[model samples]
Structures are given as structure tokens and as C-alpha cells.
Target chain A: MTGRTRRPPTGAAVLQPHITSAITEAVLDELAERGYGRLSMEGVARRAGVGKSALYRRWPCKQDMVLAVLSQMSVPLAEFPDTGSLRGDLIAGLGAVHDWLTHPRFVLILPDLTAEAARNPALAEAIQATIGTPRRQLASAALHRAVERGELPAGLNLELALDLIAAPIHWRLNVRRAPIEPGYLEALADHLMRALGATERH
Target chain B: MTGRTRRPPTGAAVLQPHITSAITEAVLDELAERGYGRLSMEGVARRAGVGKSALYRRWPCKQDMVLAVLSQMSVPLAEFPDTGSLRGDLIAGLGAVHDWLTHPRFVLILPDLTAEAARNPALAEAIQATIGTPRRQLASAALHRAVERGELPAGLNLELALDLIAAPIHWRLNVRRAPIEPGYLEALADHLMRALGATERH
Candidate 1:
């Protein structure tokens, strides 16, 4: 059997990257305009200039489609680098969060989807599995590294620390819909360092 | 002129307290089920057993009606009582936020409305004016009281502090969708005391 014919049943033959990009953009635009509660597969298909079968081949249903697209868009947005000092790492982490929250498309789509998830139990579970869990795990790595470097206590409350690290920025941008001013990330990181019981490096 | 004839045009006779209560309940129920984007005047009126006129009489449109109902329900949820110390005040304030976020109806409604507000500029403005501004002003008093008591620095960043005060709890409840542990509030308050640069009380 040739490698081309033996390709896994991913339907890679049908689901081209460029087509996937088009569908992804359409999903976001539709979600932004109509919200998750109002979003329909037909609308997405129409907007993406693809047949319903094209979407079906990729995802079983609307919920799966939305979750898959959002997971791809979100999971990589907050990359916490090893900046040596915990303060530097936190500041860099907060900056990543700030950038992701304020992204032109994301700023609109996220709050709406989160709101939708509040009312949809199945959707909520899907979000936690795909978006929330993975994002938290990646972000938790920075804190784990800080602990290894003797920057934080071994008995550190990792769950609470993770919450503290991400929540403030999320609240400001998503809930309050407020703008982040100059030096806001630095100030927030410093405050968080104190809050987490970490010794200041500088 | 009789006092009845000269009564202000508030339609107080038609908008009796009991009727208002029914309408308010209906609005909340409709919002919880259908969300802001899908909520309609007819649905609310039908749920309340009132005519559409009853709703329009209260507010010019659905946006105004939903905003009024939510504002009445929310603006009072975050009352910051003076506990005579910064840590005490913050813990008390965090408890209030935790209660509001976890309220059965609000737990379902707030995130949905916040999402809708992101897309609807008019709704966002009304919410800010009616809900966000009043809530912040009330919570801010706790910090001001701390400053007066010399528990906190006068140069404290009030806006950032306010964001810090509420964000973590809001994040844990609304975004993370996780259960807060038994000692979470107290722990959060202590951490916040450090973050806000307030001296520990005990």
C-alpha cells in the first residue's frame, strides 16, 4: 500500500490547512457577530464558502466545531517563558495574558463564549477539557519552575497561585471590559509576587 | 389638586410593588433561560402574565428592561462593610463577592450578560453606568477606610487595588468554574493584604 492511500482516517485529504483556516475565521466572525447561543452550522458553512459536509468531516456537530477552533486559537496564547527570576517570569506571563485577552478577535469572542458556557453544561465541560485544563497546565509550568529554582515555598498552594496568576488580568479585561494602562503588567506582576509569598528579586 | 392626581408620572398605581416584583422575577428567569441576546419583551411579559405594555411602560426597550432588572439585582450584592481593619475589610468584601458569584441565578446570569455586553455597546454602557460604576465606588470605600486608619499607604493604586480585590474570586468562580476551598477566602485576603502593600493586622 502506498503512503498516500494509507494516510490515517483524519480526512487530511479533505481537510486542507487553508480550508481549515477559512473555516476557523468564519467560526470566530460568526461567533463574534451572533454569539454562541445564536451560532449555527449553516451560517458558518455559508460564511466559509464551504458545504455542510466540509464542516461535518471535521467536527461532528456545532459544539465540537466551536470547541476545536477555540482550543486551537487559545491553547498557545499564554506561553510562560523561563525568565530566570520569578518576577521576570510572572511579568512575562502576565504580558502574554494581556496580549491574548486584548487580541482584536479574542477580546470579543472570549467573553461571549464564556457567557454561553455558563448556560450550557455540555459546552462548559468541553471548554474545561479542551481550553481551560490545557491552558492552566501550561501556565502552571512557570510556577513549577519557580519552585524548582527555590523562588517559592515547596508547600506553595499551586492551585491558588495559578488562579492568582491569571484571574486579575482576566477579570479586568473580560468582566470589567476596562483598558490596561502603561506599566500595568509590571505592577500586577510585582503585586502577584508579593501575594504568592515570593521574595522580591529586585 | 388631589395628591393622587398630582402624583408623579411614575405609574406607581400600575407599577405596584407586587407587580414590579413579579416582573422582576420574570426578567431574571427569562435571562437565565434564554440569555440577553435571545431574551424578548414578549417572553418576559408572557412569563410575568403581563402585557407587553407593562414591560414597555417600565423601560423603552428590552435592553433597558434587562439592564434595570440586573442593576437592581447586582448593585447591592457587593456591600463593603467596615470591619475596622484592612484585612478584615478585604475578607468581608471577598466573602460578599464569593456569595454573589455563586448565587444560583447569578451564577448562570452574570457571565452570560457580560458576554452579551461585549457585543452590544449600548448594553455595555448601561451596565457600566448602572452596575459596574456603583459597585466599584462602594467597594473602594473599604480601601479608603484603610488609608484613613493608616493600615495602607495613601499612595496606593486604588484602581489596580480594586481590580486585585475582586478579580481572583471572580476568576475562580466564573472563569475557572472551580470550587473554592474552605480557607480560600481568608487565604486570599491575607495574600491581597500583601499585594496591596497593607500591613498585616494579626
Candidate 2:
């Protein structure tokens, strides 16, 4: 009776890395093709060429699976490198934003996910926790480093600055669906430096 | 045959203003609740308490119907009022953007339409034509006036400047689902003036 009571659930096996990768690709593809609202577990499993049990082993439902894959890809993609100067850092950070928003699969998936998230508040909160907060923290750390180095005002509005830093690229690529012209990112970094009241030499 | 060709086609009757308003409200309500993909002519007709022929009388298809309703609401909303200085102009223009984006119906409808537009190229083009271009032209006229008034540089990058002016607020309200703090719009305007190299006094 004790042994039977202590037994683990049947589908609680460890996920294989290859299967995880395949599932990730399938989630993105499914999102791109059909969008978040229409995505189904069976569809993802079929696309990944994995059985239902394999998916249940990793994530119990579609939202969990999608969020996990998205978080794994997005959180690290937001890493703001230590480029020594605030200008260099802004360029590096916003450049990552540009690349992510312009990535072929992401270009399709993000807007759909955003639409879905707006409708589903729980999903919106989940996304904020998994992706938005962590990404903002990385960028915030970069700005904080700039403040310590005397590049920005100690009284800087970090919340507003974060929005200013990334919104232009996002607006251009995602909302406008426009191409980034040459020298645009460097100019954007310069504009942000001034916008944040950075004291660095031009 | 000549007389028949000269005669007007069926369903070519002029639209009633009250019926148009009802249909417009129904379209927005339907879009907010069900999104663009799931919206149907029959559903809209049923919701508006009008017959299907009324819709077909105004627009031959669903895409055209949606676009016309969206255009009517969105295009005029982008008007940029002249406030003499570039800073004032930016504040007024972006304040309008803030109002439009955060409007209860638009808050729900915009993201869904953006997602649908991303997937449908024809719809995207239609939106660009009816909403995006007209809105940009109004803002562009404001910038052109600013150049004339010597508030901004003669060589200002208008396209980038326009993107900068609106993107931050859009990002804060729509993408981040964050609130605008007190004095935020004035601070944003100041930052934009600096970003644009405005010669006006701070």
C-alpha cells in the first residue's frame, strides 16, 4: 500500500532535448500559420511528430507549452551586453529588438500573440511574468549601469526611458511593417541618448 | 440590352445614416468581442438588426466593410493640430494617439486588427492606404510646418521623427499595457524635442 501510494504519475517523464526543440519549432510554426487563438495541442503534437504523452510530459496544456517555448527563446534574446558606453549599449539593445521583431517567424507570431494576450488577461499576465519582466530587467540593468557611470541622470524616469528605448524599432518593424533604413539604428541610439538626458560626449 | 445596361444594379440604393451608424457600432462591437477573422456579414447584420442586403448594399465583401468602418474611425483620429512649437505639436499629436489607442473599444480592437492585418496582405495594404498613409500625411504636415517655423532642423528625418513621436506612447499603452504617469506626456514631448534637435527653448 505504501509503494502504491508513493508511485509517480505515468506521464511525468523527463523531456528529451530534441523533442523539446522540435516542439518549439512546431509551436512557432503553428503560431505563424494559425495564430495563438487557433493553436491546438493535437496540432502541435502532429506538427512536432510526437505523441500526446510526450507533450503532456513537458507541459499540461497549450498555454504552458507556448509560454515555455516563447520564454526560452525571448528571455535570452533580450540580453543587453556590456558595451562600456550608454550609446553602445542602447544600440546593442535596440539592435536586438530590431532583429527579434524582424525575424521571419516572429514577425508573424508576435502580433498574433499580442492580440491573444489582450483578450486573455491570464495569458497576458503569464507573458508579462515570463518574457516582459525579465527582458525589461536586463535593459533596466544596462540603464542602471549608465547612471552609476554618470552617463544618465540619477533622477531619470527609468520606466519611460525603457519604453522610449525600444518602441521606435518595434513600431517601425511590427506596427508599420516598414524596413529599417541604413544608419537608422545608430541615429536611433543617438536620439535615445538625448531623450534619456545622457551626459556623454557626442 | 442597352436599356438594361444603363439601368442601375440591384442593392445600389443610397445608405441610410442611422443604419450606417448602427452597422458601424455593430462592426466595432463584433471586432472587439470576436476579432476580425471570426466576424461575419450575417453576424454583423443580425447584431445591427439589419438584413444582409444592407451590408452588401454598402460593401460587396467583409474585408471592404471592415476597412471602411475602421478607416472612418481611425483616419480623422490622427489629425495633428498645430500648436506653434515642435514640442507643443508633438504633445498634442501624441496625446491624440494616447486617447485613440487607449479608447475602450480601440484597446481591444487595434491589436486584433493588427494581427489580422499581419496575416492578410490585402487587408494590410488596405489599412495602409486608408489609415496609415492619411494619418502619416497629417503628422508629416505638422513636421513640415515645424521646419518652416525653424523649430526643427531643415534636414530633419521626417519618417524617423514621426515613428519616434508616436511609438513610445503606443508601446506603453498597447504593448506594455501600462498607465501614463502624471506629467509623462510633457516629459515625453521634451525628450522628443531633444531627440529631434529642436532649437526651441527648453
Candidate 3:
């Protein structure tokens, strides 16, 4: 047992880059087809055209492999443009999120993470760290820009501002189980900008 | 061809009432015990101490059984009170919903329902008809009462008002994977009421 104990990351630790990337792709595809509950290491190995022993040589279990796959999905901040307007920035960010939400792999992955989270509260933090924090920060930055430009209220709250822009798309996908049509997106962006727009005579 | 085409509302249909209650209890316990998919129809039947045939007789499948359980969770509305003020009425009504959202079942059920909704859009409608419509109407009536009392603008957009309140709960439960904590709910209700609140300035 002592032989396999872990230590803090060292400057010279060897990483198995090829196997991990190949396995990650295979696992994602398997999740899209079979969903989380039915996914097995054997299935992933078979699909990746590798032996079971080869997979076990890398990750100890399904959760570890899954985390490796999910961690690869870095939120690309480059896509979030600074269009010199808060609403424009928000619209771009929200629109990019639309693709991720509707991906077949996501539909399968999210439920399992949350279902596992009920028992392991720590996993909730993991999910937030991986996906939620970056998302809110991106929106918050755009809102801050708006506040600085005097486009919003004097006492406008940042967290609440993020929530305001974020909640609608979240609702559209999660609850409605429908796409936010372009028409609705236009309406939502227009309405939210107007709502947050300050009174002219104030 | 018509020999056994019809359901007795008895074989599976007749036994539905008994198993419906049993399944509801089973799901709650199983969510605690086994998470979701580890929950098998055979398992619920075995635990309920009934034959698998009996469960099959009542529910065509697991989805059907879950749908019945969800319909029963009326979750005690906070009695959208007549506080005689727009802010008061909106806050109280939203506050009540916020409390109901704290239940663990909402987290488990909402994602399950949403996943199923992706497969069966008709089930989505059934869920809405059984649950969502009434929930919306309940909040809408409270807001409508505010309009009637001359406390809010008479033309306050009802659908938008419902979205303002309802969307946040779904957002927190589904995306944030965070509990709809009271402070967040209060803040949401306060800020939303201000944003969507009917104008009184003449």
C-alpha cells in the first residue's frame, strides 16, 4: 500500500499524454451513446480499441477517467468578445454556451455528476470549480465593464447582474427542454438591456 | 386484432393507485439509497414486496411511474397572500416558492424529468400540464392580484413576471447545483421585483 502513495506534483513527473487523450475521446463517445450509468471501462476500452488492462494501467476507476475527460473541456475565454457593449458581450457568451448545453455528451454527463453529487457533496464543489466559476466570472467581468461605462445603476450589484443575464438561458435549456430560438434570444437580450438601463431623467 | 388491445385500467391501470404511492415512497428512499438508475423496476417491485407483474401492470415503464410520483408533490404553496402591496405580494409569493425549491426531491426529479423530456417531448407537455401550468398559474394569480389592487402597473407583463420568479429557481437547482438558499431567494425576489415592478411614477 505504501508503494502507491501519492505526493504533491513534482517538476519531473512523467505524464501519459497519448493514452489519456485517446481514452478521453472514447469515453465521451460512449457516454453519448450509453449514458453514465451504463458506461463501463470495458466498453470504453473496446471502443478505443485497447485492452482492459491498458485502461486500468492509467486510471483506477470510472470516476477518475471521467474527471480526466471533463477537465479537458476548458471554457475558452477567447470566444467571449469585448464588443464595447455589455449586452453584446453577454449575448456572445450566452450564444456560445448554447452549443455545449445541447451536445449529446452533455445530456448524459450532467445528470450523472449531479446524481453523484447528492451523496458526495465534494463533487459539487468540483463541478463548480470546473464549469460554474469560469462562467459566472466571464459574465461578471462584462457587467463590471457596463458599470464602469455608466451604462447601469449607481449601486448595481455584480453577482445579481450575472444572475440576471445567466438565469434565462439556463432556464430555457434546463427547464423548457427547448432551444432558445433566435427570436427569443433577441427578445431576451433587448428586454434585459432595457430593464437594466437607467432612468433618463434621474 | 382487438382481442386484448384495450387496457382494463385494472391489470396495470387498476393496480396503479396502490403502486403509485408505493413507487413514490420507493423513489424517495431509493434516491437516498441507490441514486437514480441503480433504481430498477424490478427493485422497486421487490422492495414494495409486490410482484414485478403488478408494477408493470400499473406503469408502462419507469418513466411513467416517476411521472405519477412527481404529479403528487403539490409542495404546499405559501398561500400567495394578499399583502396589499406589489413588493409585499411578489416577495411573499416568490418566498414561498423558494422554500418549496429547497426540498431534495426537486433536485433529483427536475433533472430526471428534463432528461426524459429530451426523449419524449410529449412527456414534457404532460409534466407541464400536470405540474408546470398549475405552478405558473398560482404565481400568476398572485401577481394579477397585485395589478388589480392598483399596487402594480395594470399592464405588467404576466408571462415575463412568472419567468422572472420561476426561472431563477430552475437556474439554481439545475445549473448552479446549489441549494436555493433563502438569502439568494430573497435577493432574487427583491431585485426581480425592482426590475419587473410596475412603475408608479407619474
Give the share of true interchain contacts found in each model: 0.68, 0.62, 0.26
Off by over 4 Å in 2: A1-13, B1-13
TM-score of chain B of each: 0.91, 0.91, 0.72
Give all candidates' CA lDDT scores.
0.84, 0.87, 0.66
Best by lDDT: 2
| Separate DockQ for every predicted complex | 0.68, 0.62, 0.28
lDDT score for residue A24 of model 2: 90
Cα deviation in Å at residue A61, candidate 3?
A: 5.5
Model 3: per-residue Cα lDDT over B65-168, one tens digit each? 76566656642464677777766776787777665655666656566556556556777777777777777777777888777776567767665566667676
TM-score of 1: 0.90
lDDT of 1 by residue, A86-159 (tens): 99888888888888888777878888878877767788888999998998898888888988888887888788
Predicted complex 2: DockQ: 0.62
Off by over 4 Å in 3: A1-21, A50-64, A77-79, A194-202, B1-24, B31-64, B75-79, B119-122, B149-160, B179-182, B200-202
Model 2 chain A TM-score equals 0.92
lDDT of 1 by residue, B1-202 (tens): 2347445577454565666788999999988887777789899989999888888878899888888888887778888988888887888889998888887788889998888777777787788899888899989988999999999999998888989878888887777678889999998888888888887666
